[model samples]
Target: MSDRFDPILLSELIASHKQKIADLGVVIRYNESFEELEDKLPIDSKAALTPHFATALNTYTSANAFWLGGFDEDDQLVALSAARLDDLGGQAMSEYLKRYWRRCYPAEDGDLAEASETQPRFWNEVRGRVAYYGDFHLKREGYQGRGLPKVFGPLAMLVGAQKWDADWYYTWVRERDWSMRYPLAYGFSRTYFPGLRWVKPPSSIEPDLAAGVNSRSDVLDWMETLSRPGEQALNK
Candidate 1:
């Protein structure tokens, strides 16, 4: 895709979103423990990793939780946010993920095979260098302009800074999602694979390659303005 984001325009977009949030009295807070956050958010059974949700959360060695909610004069869980973490283990991780991919995407075997073959290459590109923002969910009825994911820009950056101190971050989204634009605002570039790509390992390990793809410039522009409120042209 060609450049669609102008830094000034993106700043305005983010500012507008923030203004909408402030007007609604919405609050965003981080949850250090799963128990605290779980009590509030609804469980998504249709999630690709539904069966392993709790296991994944509980087993995560480097995970953070955040909840976006609204309260009256008093506090309560009116809305929520939930996300998990995973280290894309080279070949071993690929094997582990294949099982889940097979279940969630049974018909995608050919794509998975190709991903597997490229696993070593991809992992070498990612590995300890990148952190995957597994999944994020927001309540349907929460006070909304575009919903929490649109506002999740700062939260994701915070998580990355505190947990991984990562150079880059990545997440997979369904092909048709409108939210795909949100990540770009936060500086995550999408990878273009010919088919659904699976993580595969090389027959032999080789030197790591330099990072290539990245979030589009417009997305990066928005990300840069996140920490500076006055600099932010977006509402909020």
Candidate 2:
């Protein structure tokens, strides 16, 4: 739904990278001809639709989304990640934010339900100026230590930035991922705590952290190395 980022293009770029990843012994696929996968995505899960999931599905349904899957050499799904773009900073946007954010983390510093109180400042400062990336999930088994985040993170932001020309980008990541230093290397604050979670990360582990970036850097340039045929077509 965002005018700034080309979800379709990013999806294509990701899909084309599958062969390169395959060359490394792991085959990955990004969204290509997504509509054909409609029956494939929601047919297996039966978990209770939590507010968070519901909202995420809504965002996923929007045009600003990218889905990636890492398949075994046999073509079985081993790892996957999905991300969506969200904008904040207006009366309508504030309400949409509260609808889902309150369920997870809604405070300036781990407060857990003050989004309304902070809506003005959030709206005033970041509304329309910033873009948020959320609903990203990556499984651990088939893709460990393979530098997925380094590639995916910057690519997502690049598409987001290209679409909106927004001031910054943010995402919620578990504490462990935060401790790894990749996010900080990409330009997000390492110690900042914008929101505390209630049931996020499934309540059995550490809370998630909201990380963000304001501009491009060398870390983003690393994405250039990931270029493949899918992206080449975009340039022409």
Candidate 3:
């Protein structure tokens, strides 16, 4: 993973993703003035937009950028996706993440402190840096397979690769959830991280992506096989 990422660089990645969404006929606006932002994207009522705004702002404040999904023509929100640098702190932000972790993982496994320790090892073994990439949503009506991942996942990866200097990227997904299929299709593999629980979304579609041999496993095999071989071994 590239190790030079900072807050500003991360923000640029979010901006680029926003542009891509716009190109796809979606509107992704940042709340420059929190007050104006609040006015434009109200949260008082019980609606999808409230959580979307809250999650987006929280991610931006903590992680540099958030990609909130919405339709341009109708101005309806469809899904939310975001990433934050591994550092950045605040009670609200911590609490927000805690809630998601609790929802996504099992309470019996352990607390956050124990669970967080696995991150470094996971990164090293997987050859990827950790970036939080959830809060994904898709309105039931607008959901379609054709362009969603192309619109968000690769954009996030490009942003992560460029800004964060990340060689690889990782996210937590529930085992049974169909969304997990998207990452696998994109070359992410399942490695064990303790204390993470797999939660099922209310409804999910089976993922449709090309599959061949296990790409991640191949990466590991190449490293193990070529660590020091033949002439190199003889020289050593």
TM-score of each: 0.53, 0.54, 0.46
Scored by lDDT, model 3 comes in at 0.40
Give Cα distance to truth, residue 140, candidate 1, Å: 3.2
Residue-level lDDT tens digits of model 2 in 47-113? 2222333444444554555555555677655444444556554534435555566565344455454
Candidate 3 differs from the real structure by a C-alpha RMSD in angstroms, to one decimal, of 11.4
lDDT of each: 0.43, 0.47, 0.40
Highest TM-score model number: 2
Root-mean-square deviation of each candidate, in angstroms?
A: 9.5, 8.3, 11.4
Question: Candidate 1 — what's its lDDT?
Answer: 0.43
Better of 2 and 3 by TM-score: 2
Best by lDDT: 2
- Model 2 RMSD in Å is 8.3
> Per-residue lDDT of 1-236 in model 3, one digit per residue for the tens?
33343446445555765676777677754322322333333222324332323544343452444444455587654544444444322222222333444443333334321123222233233223334454445444454654655456545444444445433344544445434455543324444433132233112212121111122333233223223357324422
Ranking according to lDDT, highest score first: 2, 1, 3
Q: lDDT of model 1 at residue 103?
A: 40
